[model samples]
Target: VLTGFASRYAEPESQTITIVKDNLKAVPARDFNLGIEYGAVYTIKRPDSWEIIYNGTIVNSLHEPVPVKNLTLYFEDFDEFVEIATIDTDENSNFYFNYTKYGNIEQNPLVRIMYKGDGLYNPLDHIEYGGIEMGADQNWWFYDEDGDGWPEWPFTLYDLFAALQIESSPTTSDLSVYLAWMAEFNENSGTSTFDIVSNLEGLLKGNTSWTSGRRDSGLLFDGDGIITPPQSTGFVKSVQYKELVFSTSDVTKSIALDVGTNISNTIPFVTIKENVGDDWDDIMVDVYFTDSPATVYAQRSTSGATITVSIFIVEFDDVKVKVQSGTFSNTGTFAEETISQINTSKAIPMAYYKASGGDDDWDASMVTTDFTDTTTIRMERHGSSGTMSGHYYVFEAQDSEFSVQKAVLSMSSSQGYDTASINSVNMSKSFIVSSYESDRANDDPEDGALDVFLNSATEVRAERHSETSYFNGFPTINVFVITFTGAESVQRGDFTWANSDTFKETDITAVDLGSSMIKSGNMYGIMQSDGTGSSDVKSAFVQHEFVDTDTIRLERYTNNEDGKGHWEVIEWELMSSSPAVYEDFDYLLWNDILDNVFGNTSNQFVVTSWIYPTALTSNQSSNNVKNVFFSKDGMIEIGINESGYLELFLSTDLVQTTARYGIEGLIQTNEFTYIAIRYNESDVDIFIDDFWYRSAVGSIGEPWSGSVNITSGGDLIIGAELIKYSSFTGKLDDIS
Candidate 1:
């Protein structure tokens, strides 16, 4: 028996135990128990044969040796894993063990090292010598029970050392050895693991090495899950610029380009500068793209002159641009003031044109400029004055979030009709396409007089009003398409003309930004008239403004209501810094703000928060009521009632009667709602998303008045109620 001075049990210094006689009985310790009842005993015999020595070092995911201190390791027989001997690792994580055996020695043994973990490092285990069979003739290394393309056991390890996806010069043996050395430390450390096999998948093959950027190294992702040479400077996802020259005597010609599949989110910008023709300034260029063949076409046109067009194609990711194409007539007078105002809103505008309209000054040099504001686009003829008209395209400033597609169509019929089909974007999203006459060799008005219609969400039909045949040939029209996504795109479709004047009324649901984003005088848009009749393509222009949170009213600048106007509205929310991401099922308890707001007798203040509720019905506690938002016991409470309506309950001391006050169906599920409650000396007003718009008018009962005395000393819980039985499920942000 051994007795400890400090701990209940202590290990003896000597490990070898020898017994000369066979008949012996082991007795348990009585009073001097020291808490240890039954102990494991291993029979180790000394042999006269060869000796085996094993030496190894414990390292972390970074491959740096970690000091495990005085950690113990076990060596056991392979079949039954019976413990043969035990050894401890030194401060440098190095361990050495040697054992000699005779004729009864096992062929292989298992060396098991387990780290219980400390404050700084996580627990890990390593098994050496023999391997473990998972099942179905599969070993531990290649086992993937979930079939997630990656080994399920090492998933936690991969997440912990994400930067070390595939080890340096990894082979079958190298990966198996390394994986056995570093177990699942990340999951044991209680760290969140990233799903490596989600939406966009890439297959990693042999010998590929990925470092964690710790040593200033970088990686490249080829769109189809392949990797390229490492870039020493930094990582760039996408950047490509290709310049191609197309020379032709024909007025309009297109050349195709084969861009590989390495590019994701294609935003192709096409620009043209003259290479051969003296009249290069008069040439207009357009481009088209297809997905299957991954082909891009660049088309150019010039009036009768043979031109070599240098087309520059720059591809970028996440760029927003809007195209507005139309026709502007110019007087032959030199420097004639031909002012046409285009409401480009907040977008930076750039305009381009090619001569049309069969005017004598078709060959003259003309340029369009925006002088005072982006709203007005002015064209001036620098050459000798002769009446002329030309088709123009005004592009909004470069935005990082717009998806754009460009194409050109040849107007075939003698009646001037053509259809441009765009497949690059989803028509269900807010989309717009504009078309203008280009590459007609002869500047004939019949070919240039264009009126475009939104035939369907994905198709735009163009028609020239004149019935006359083309003087030279059928002219080609250029179409520019842009689709809005996320918070940037406001709404789409045709405008509904109200009986009053030329005002078009439409309803739009936007992010409740807490402030009016698309207000009057700040709204800019492009309006195209979709005529009601076959031959009714009259001029339609409008100025738009926000009537309220749900309605937009567009008043016509020209009262000629010959056709309904189709519009695409865009708004840019420019913030100096990024906003906080919305959180789910989480809360922040603030006791500091209690004294400032609810201290005085007249508790008159407003509390606002943006919340997206997944469900208003309580499925958690026995109590049906779930305090959905804010609560202060015996003072004030705001929660979802049994009927799923937001109810504001006040203490009887303040309102003189205990009553539930709220609007009908104000707080809805699955919608981001900005809720605000205000209390003055007289009555409490509730606002949902809009400040000026009150929910009191939409209430089922009459408005309730309260006394000036309202006080609460409880802590302010931002997301959930005081007792957290039933909590909010969805996301919450910007609590004030």
Candidate 2:
């Protein structure tokens, strides 16, 4: 019977068996069968009960079927089986359970299966067999247990009780004790057992810190479990670093940055630190980006001493820039891009034209390309043929359109007679001409001629003439004519001169002939006639004096026919003369006498003269005042006194001996002397040649009670006082 039992129970049996495939498919098939036989007491052996069969190879952790052995399996059904089955896997790690006592097991019943580890296998509890239905709630259950909502297929014991739920026997007490231990173990393990699971969940949920061993399994992290990588905002996608330096001086400086070719926004952070001997006062630093002429990130006006500036540029997309530049030349064609890259179609090609060296007399014109095609521009010197070459700058216009209008001035010359014609557009013009002629013969019949003409369609003309004419013949006839073309013009003889034997006109008026001529003494010669055989030889002298406005006195003296041909006054009369001549003099002399001009003698008196003394009187008495100017009573005198010195004196009550001031040491001979005497009530001052010579302080009494007399009636002599006493023997001028 034992042999028969052995034959039936030799193979392990179980209600259910699970074969774990550790990520392997090429595994040999294995079978585990349990056979049990009763040897005593019972005459018949019960058939193997509750047989569980697993006919597959054991797999590795990857679930692939791998060739491994001694894999223990524990099978239990808490709701159905009163006994549990435990078996060891074969070389293939496959098992079977066969129990004759129990027929086919019910479906959907609670069960537990534990994998007892072997040399190649790590032990694990896989519970919940047939009766454990996968529900939506179970999805959440796995997520709660492992903090990852992903389902694990082929449920294990850990899924049900958080621990291995294998029992030695399928009994209520065993299951209770196992569950209690599992609960205690779960309490002890805390959340650490699901750390790997949580990490995997974090990887799928986009968490930051999930690590294994020494490396991160999910997101990169620091030692403090903080996220290392930047978050995504769907707009800003990246991070970058850049270093920039700006060297600046006292003047404004600019630095260009390499932010990138394409950018939307630019945020620049600048830190400026001044070096030694650097001045930061009133220094400005700015950073920005531009896309004109070229894409440039720039910093402007960072000025100080030696300074270091750090700039952080943040660049993005969606930002735009426009650049504009120009090339200029005065004598050559310049090549430049006239179109803007930012707004190529809207760009306006522009040009500037100016005289090469700032000349305003020449014409200049500016031209631009059509708005539709502004890629290039050509500017050429334009206008009148002689217009000067000009500087030109071509660029994209800042405004919508650009154009220029100009005027031209041209000059040409043609010579015939002595006239010049000028034509100009938008210009005011003027000119002048001069001609000279030699003296002509007295008898020559040719007449001097001058003509002027001016014509203009839109301008007004004015003319002026200055002329002078003279003749060497007597009874000469001269004629002048002028003509005008317009209807408002008056026709008249402009000038005429004639003389005949019957008229015998000896007085003549002067006229302008627009030329320089010779003058005879005080008269401008008009005409002359030579003596003939019938007429006695005659000669005349004419004199003219301008007396007042429009009036002149003329005196003519003719030679008498007494055979001696002596000149005699023939006519003396007054006539009209226009345009009086102006005379200028260099010096004035007092030749006319001043008699009794001073009505009375005062306490103060001054006598002055500029003179050149030539001689001195030898018989003059030293007690008498040899006066240059003497009053009637001898109360005032300006002359040499008793001391033989040039002096000015005032006597009291016409007493000659009471002379108050006899200024001495001022007598000059043969040299021009400026002598002056200033006498006040208390003092006298003498000046020689505009310099102070001597002075005396005292009471000077009033002299002449009557009017002050000078030269007293005898034509008031100048060189001689009263034509007898103290006559000046030298030239005297400017005496007062």
Candidate 3:
């Protein structure tokens, strides 16, 4: 009987339905379920021009339709999913709603189509196909996380959607947790979303709480955490303090401090305060650092009575210190340490050279010892000749045991009637004898001798002189003895003239008197003549006739037959005097000494001098800049440009890979200016008048190598270069 009833009632038939309104077109409905309530699932075909609206503006759109299914048609509000029909798309890709006969329809009503997935779309995934007011306040916006054209609503039903997808009760009160859960849901699903939701639940339940304490206490949450003070706390990393006490008799006080660790690269802030007795005014205080284990000096005023000095150092490491008091300029010394202990090994083996006018060039001969023993080093200069001039030089081993030697000479002279000779001489070294003689009757005029051999290295004797007159008259002679040793050289002349008969205007000339060695000073000599008869006798006198750098003249007296004396022939003898021309810009060139001093090694050095620029050179070319000091081949130079700018250049090679620093208008005419240049590797610093002027970075070359033979091919030139015409036109002093 049931078979017959089934056969009599036909099976529910499926049908297709198409819905289109305005610009909205849905997928055709198919295979409608008739008997069961909410039986069929349906899908709406996405519009050909479907757009993603965000805050009243369309952010993105799909120009083509998409097949959608399992869509639940809802009425009115979004959360009220009272479905009048459940719709889905069939094989034709058309959506159909299963309409129950008792369902009611409202015209142009607000609706929200809810889509739940059947292996394709997840629940809570929905689209508003119609009834969305244009320009209305948007409660949701579309966000494309992966740029896939298909956008997801960022916060649309975000909490409910997250709960439904995660299948966990995550609190929605915390917006951060909710947003995090939404992100996890959209980007990752299944186990990933579940894990995120579980962690968020734990975070909400375990809430953050402040621990009941100060300083050492922190935040108490699911796990203990460190608490950092806010920026307003004004925290200090480290600090150091020191105090110095001084008595009425004390002129100065110092304190030593150890900053615990090396703070070489860090800048420290230092402050000092002084407190003297009420009767005394403010005292001066100075804070400084001294090497040899790196000590800090906190000094107090010397004049105040019972003063206290307070020193504060901040931003340094933990340190401890000691205080000391003493008189001014009498600060006690620190214990000496080896060079290596104080990181001064590089400064050892230091060399210095100084040169003045008329001094010999500095060379390897100046350095008596190697760097290993600085005490043995020495420097000496060949003494000046022909002039008493201001020329001196000093070279010694700094901070070492060394001494310099000087040469001293003792000399004497004698004279006779017609001959001259050196009587006796005592010298520290070998000596030379110079003599002059004149005989009128013998036809001998002024005569001079030089470089005569001494009897001994330290002492010399002159043979007794005897002169026979041609006319049976007494002879006359004169001699000069000059002894020299240890780099001392000088020139001297002695003259003797005699005549028996009255003579007139006889010209006498001296020869080979060592004129090149002459020095200007007083002249001394002797003159005598014989008388014919008692009535014919006359007084004898010597007259300085004329003088030059190399020669001098003396006129002798003669008696006439009437007993009247007159001037006779003048005698010309050689004398010493200074050379006429001495240039102010004259320079000294030390051949190839740079190579011996600074070889192809790396070095940090400073060059400093006080210069008075009296004049600028006529040459305006940059290449013709006046050189105050320089190394041959231009490896290092301190010069003035055409514009009177002081320039410094340090090169690795001859005119190659050089670093240059300069200051405009650094040199003022006729004014003394202090200039200094410090060079380390590729960095160059220029200072003028003790203030920083300019700097250059990079390209400072390697030190000149001794193998380059600067002594032969180049030189450390002062005032000018060997091949260049440029020369400094001013005075230079205290150059280092």
Ranking 2 against 3 by lDDT, winner:
3
Tens-digit lDDT track for model 3 on 366-463? 11111223222111212221111111111121221111221222122233212223333333222221222112222111111111223333333322
What order do you get sorting by lDDT, best first? Answer: 1, 3, 2
Q: List per-candidate RMSD values in Å.
A: 29.8, 58.5, 35.3
lDDT of 1 by residue, 1-736 (tens): 4456544655769778864411111111111222112111111223344333445566665555665654445556446554445555567656655544455544334555566666666665555543221110111122334543223222122222432344422232334332312111112112121112221111222211231221222111111112233322211123333444444455545444444532232333332323222233224434444456555444433444333332222232223334444445556422222234433432322333444433332224223233244445544443433334443345553433445554455555454567877664555443444423233333332333344544566676655533343322344444445555544344555654432345567788753322223211001122333323212211233444455667766554222323344544334333222322222334334443344455546446555545566566552222233544555444555656444455565543345222344556766766666565666664676655422233343433324454675765466544454443334545443333
Each prediction's number of clashing residue pairs: 7, 71, 39
Q: List the residue pairs that clash in candidate 1.
A: 318-400, 319-402, 320-399, 320-402, 332-385, 332-386, 358-443
User: How do the residues 1-736 of candidate 2 rate in per-residue lDDT, one tens digit apiece?
Assistant: 2674474435666797777533322122421111111110001112433323322345665655444434333334445534355555555455444323254344333334455555445565444332113211111111222423212221222222222343332233333432211111111211221111111110111111222211112111110112233322211212222334345444333444443433334333332333221111212233334554213232332243343333333332221212333443434222233444323322222222222322111112111222234454444332222222212222221232211111111111111122223333121111111111212222121111121222231221211111212221111111101111111111111111122221122322331211101111101111122222212111111222222322323222222211110111111011122432212111111222223332233444455444455555542323354535322233444555434366444443333342434344455555555455555553445555423434332453333334232222223222333322343444444333
- Measured by TM-score, how close is model 2 to the native structure? 0.17
Better of 1 and 3 by lDDT: 1
Cα-based TM-score, every candidate: 0.26, 0.17, 0.19
**How high is the CA lDDT of each candidate model?**
0.40, 0.29, 0.32
Q: Who wins the lDDT comparison?
A: 1
Error of 1 at 84 (Å): 69
